[model samples]
Target: MCSTVVTPTDRVQPDVALPFGGWSAIVRDMSEEQSTSEPTRAFREARDFLLAHREDYETAYRDFDWPRFDRFNWACDWFDALAVEQPGVAALTIVEEDGEVNSLTYAEMAERSRQVAGWLTGAGLQPGDRVLIVLGNTIPLWEVMLACIRAGAVMIPATTLLTDADLADRITRGGVRAVVTSSSEAPRYEGIADHCIRVGIGGPVDGWLDYEDSRGYDGPVPEVDTAAHDSLLLYFTSGTTSQPKLVEHTQVSYPVGHLSTMYWIGLQPGDVHLNVSSPGWAKHSWSNVFAPWNAGATVFLCNYTRFDAEKMLQVLATYGVTTFCAPPTVWRMLIQADLSAVEIQIRECISAGEPLNPEVIEQVRNAWDVTIRDGYGQTETTAQIGNPPGQPVKLGSMGRPLPGYSIALVDPTTDEVGDDGEICIELAPPPVPLMRGYRDAKELTEESMRGGFYHTGDVASRDEEGYITYVGRSDDVFKASDYRISPFELESVLIEHPAVAEAAVVPSPDPVRLAVPKAYVVLAAGREPSRELAGEILQFCRDHLAPYKRIRRIEFAELPKTISGKIRRVELRADEAAKVDGGERTEHSYDEADFKQA
Candidate 1:
């Protein structure tokens, strides 16, 4: 299922990865503007190094350095540079469900964003103002992003799916000063941020300025002279807890940090890159906005209210998509459809949001002749580990530490380095990609970056050859019958069953054994829930899994997920805990002992 995307014959040996700084460097004795360009140079040098070594991981990882910047504005320096270099090249293209297409070339995008910046500035937007954006993959979203950067305003990306209450919390937490949304979504902001300036797209609304007005503002908006440490975006992480955490990204952090993301994705200039991600989440910025564009590739989008794998494949082929990124959920849905039916010219495929099942990767490689590489990242930083292009990828491993990242697996009990432990990023010099910290939560921030490392709070196992296979979340990994269990491992096996489409494994309380593994499964299309089906699955699990690891209980239900589509195992585990304490029988649950072993 795994194969190298490039050969040694493709490029010569000058391919070194981004190794700009292990010690943070700030250019001295230079003008403020000149100093800004110095880090930009350092950033570009590092970027070009990764591009040169896109297929040569061994040399890249060993030699890569982190670029340091004191002042960096990506929208002005980097994006505008690309626009000037490749004016007529496609930068953004979106296909609507009705077959209508909208596009902007690099030059056109730059011009439009400049116009938007001018309009927003004229309408009372000031430097450091937080603008909450709630929109789909439309033209204005891109325009506002660049516009915010030009004005030195911090952008807070919110999904169209947010309710009025969600908007209130974000406005209060993020300190809203303005709001940009579609005419349809403008109503959601009423009384949320009442004094906040409202710019609505599509059509005019009462007490709201139309985005169409920006078309008339013809003058260019000058760039804001911003420091690298200035906050550019505030992301509210999708959390399983009651309230989400606000993650702050600096002007350089995402814009410059995504050089690592660009390297991991193996993006090349002029390639049409499509990443399936919601706008509000960090992954959207990781792949959709920053990564592909960081590589000077086209950011492609297909707007849809519902997912249709066949229709999506059609769009992919029609647009000649060269690079594709989708979540594990989308990949699972694609495998259910007839993938061979659609002929795509996709050269690179990546899965994020969760670890992709090996079975899903095998299915895709069989049909497309290209492997679906998996990557590991978090909202706190850019891509840390990934199977880069042309590298020999291990089936379950998410490759090694990216060019700028220094990964360590530290044992929880002893705080010693080990092969299997919590994934932590070396922070002695601090990677540029790391977030400034948790916004307004200094205690939590210090706690996370404590002990000379930025703890990822995720666990994994590193093999002898340097491949890291994902275990489960630190919280989700539990002990069953005194043996540690990884939910990801069990869920990976469950999905291999013919009847199962998606699965989440959690520790179920058991009086005799202390705890046992239980699975909550969603059946494949045309498969109905019944004791017959559950028994069949139990038998399958019993046959394939170890005795202690076998599924002791099964429940047929839709998995609980965050709005960003990540399955929430903590919720399921909580349910199991309540059942054990209350002595309540779980509804629609089937016990493996009901169908005794042969």
Candidate 2:
């Protein structure tokens, strides 16, 4: 049976004698200072500013000031300040492919980044010029990121897994002026323009600047004026539903907006936070760069080429990772592994990127004796809704809105506030962490920002207690025989089966009905793709779901996905329409007629 918490009718009153603690204690300890009589004034100032202006858009936008600094560097001003006092504190730790370990201290990283920034300046890298950072989870990757941050240069982060075509698209679209990558991957950029300087990290490549020499620079850190509104990073959206759009972020948006993330993750000073996310994705910056560091927590990394669940568990035990965040895919894999044998010291386990299935949540809670909190957000924003530490977590609901966020469920057709519809922000000119419109797409931005609200394009339903439940993407949802169908709801149920590894549900074209639900599934290890297995899954869904939401068809194959890991339901929907036009049907499908009693 699912361990689902029913929604409450009103705000939960805090009890005085709660065992673990309330949110206040978490926030206070997270922002506490070291070796000083006063609290961390800088953090407190920033947090107080945000709290004072919470939900007040005009005052927050107009008066909530950015940190004043004519000669300010986040690495130097913030990180260096901490490093000088705590030189031995671990800043970054990574596990290598050869079973060796590498770690960098706060002071060492600060000095290294300063040297790299000086070297890049000498190499003719100027402020405002875009640099494409394509590297894996290595020490140099973090160094380069901090160096870029210190240099006041806009960074276009690309994953090492990107192909030549993908690189070409980013280079052309992002207007990159330089490139930094490992020497082993230098061959991919052989024919690119000479204007784009190549800085190889590992070793000297032909005609490329060697990053190793950057360590020899003995000059003091270069000083520059970095305004808060200045663009710090440019991210390309993962093109799951459409073409990738360049998303721009300012110095303050991520740096300040992640206050909510720090609170959501329950990060505290002296805590070690481990997040499983590849470089180039926004989530990497969310957990690895901004959130944990904002809370003064140590950012930990466990690098692996291919995922090994057992090895990951051992690392958590060995490293004493205090807080952890991973996507649902990783969490699902962990449930299938022998979790009882692994001892995890994790205080909190959180899931984002997609909604967490109730079954997966229960399995982990049973094994680890900790609740896995569910969070909601997008590539364009910070954590909007989440079960913060000490808050009640309702199963299948993406918790309440975070402290600063105000969510309204508006009926798209009626343009009125309702219990279920498009999730939107009612305040005109939405809050921080929201993208400053899609880069170079004015029409698209205006369309999304219409009706005096920022539309999420995703649908959700809210209960009387304000707990929001994710429905489905507006485009992916459809009606079959006058009944609305949510693909995510059905897909969530399908993944509960032990035979299923991943599943994507879409509407299959039908003659009598407008459409019917069809599931595309990836089988787990040791499971075969067969009609018998497909029939078993179909039967399981039919037994669990309501009659209107039953899975009528099944296909055993790899689900189509974007370059990023998101499943592409749009592609599946189009393919199903084409197949129906061609008079094709899967042999394993079952209709209501197939289950009739004579």
Candidate 3:
């Protein structure tokens, strides 16, 4: 067993011997130091309350309260405390496609992160300094995050897939003072900034500090007087409609606020949780770091160059993943495979990133004997709505308001509370999970926080039972022949067809009806696009949808998506409008008018 000795002052004592065979940290008996910090006690009580009533949604929702913290550092007070209490427990496990598995226990991670924190301070990454971290789902990614938290440095996570131009934009706009990236990606910053600090992972690079050197630092971690409201993270939103907005989160916002997310995922201590999301996105931290770790669960990651359904199933069984969360895209793909072929132990399954179709959820439930719950949230906040464990899930609804959040559906035009309108979060007390504001954009922030609520820009309709079913984005919902239409409703139906792999519905400009619903589809494996196939698809829609909502045009093509894997329907809408203005038709588009009645 390994342990950390924390004093009443929250400082580590002299190094103690550990059986795990890594760097020695100030080891202590957690039972003796359980009440060392008030913040720790408060945080634990709130967490324990949720865990005690995970399935009892009524009690959890009614009695749960956000922990009040005037001064709190989650890494020091919570994660470190967990490390001392459950030092031998695996905190993170990363399995590679090549069959290599790397595991880090709680005690090891604490010490390693401290070493990294020391190295960072020594290297001039001081408190409040912004560091751009560009790496994949590797061990250092988690290490750096913890170290940054401990060091009180603001972090801006960047995807490895970012181009040179993207890096320049982030470095310029984010005010990045330092960059830690793989050596291979170092060359991309040649002309960006020569004076900025460069720390390379993987191996040594010219003029770049080697990250491997951090392991040698056994010095005490630098003291960080981080205020509870100090900015801790800056996330660049995926630009679906316009320029990416820089979202700012404080120390308490993401770290303490993720308690709601922990409850939504139904995470339990010692549970193995697997979430499929790339490193740069907010969802990555939502599950991979804060949510699971907040519940004292192991964060499991299966890394592959490309997604393989069968291989993923095997990994799930191999690691004994108790909780699994993936995007709607992954769930749809999983249904295409022989899901029953693998015997797994996934107890709680969840779908997020986008509203999951009922068809995908039904297939997974039939095969796995566990319902795939759907959740809703954005980069601006933690889970605001979800079908948590023990709740009777509605077919298309994203469930009820999560604990700590007060949801309101308001008419966008009149700003009146209604059953069907834009989803909004009440700001009466202002939930802890909500973002501080958009960085460097004062006007936009004010606009979002207007009318005593944070406008989510997405539309939804709440049933009498309080379950909210997502409609399209406020801008995505259009009118065809003076009738309101939702693209998601039609796209969900389109994807149910066996030949369709992915479908995006957008308003196709027409002089006759003013506008009509058009579907841009991607064919499934072994299926080819043709006139006959297009007609069949249109017929399928005609049979399922009402007369006004029928798809008037069908085109088989790849849908454009942002770097974060969200579909950019704005592009398709613009393309269709331009085509009508130029009096031209897309070469591959097939109109329903061409297909005559029998």
What are the TM-scores, per candidate, against the unseen true structure? 0.92, 0.87, 0.95
How much does candidate 2 score in TM-score?
0.87
Top model by lDDT, which number? 3
Ranking, lDDT, top scorer first: 3, 1, 2
Q: Cα RMSD to native, each candidate?
A: 7.4, 9.4, 4.5
Clashes of each: 7, 0, 4
Per-model lDDT: 0.84, 0.75, 0.86
What is the Å distance of residue 350 in model 2 from its true position? 0.8
Candidate 2 lDDT by residue in tens digits, 1-598: 1111121122112112211232233224433243221223454466555444444434543454334332334654566555555555667777775766676766566667777888898888888889999988888888988888888888898888887988888888888888999999998987663569789988898899999888667655564557766777889887755678888877656766787777678776666788998898888888998887665567788878788888888888877888899888788788778888977788988888778888888988899988898888777778787777766778899877775567888887998988999988755546766777777889988888887887888899998877899998889889998899988899889988999878898998888779989888888878987656766788889789998999887888787765445677899999889988998767544444454320
lDDT of 3 by residue, 47-81 (tens): 88888889998898898888888887888888888
lDDT of 1 by residue, 343-419 (tens): 88899999998899888999999999999988999999999999999988788888899988899999988899989
Ranking by TM-score: 3, 1, 2
Give the lDDT of residue 425 in candidate 3: 95
lDDT of 2: 0.75
**Number of the top TM-score candidate:** 3
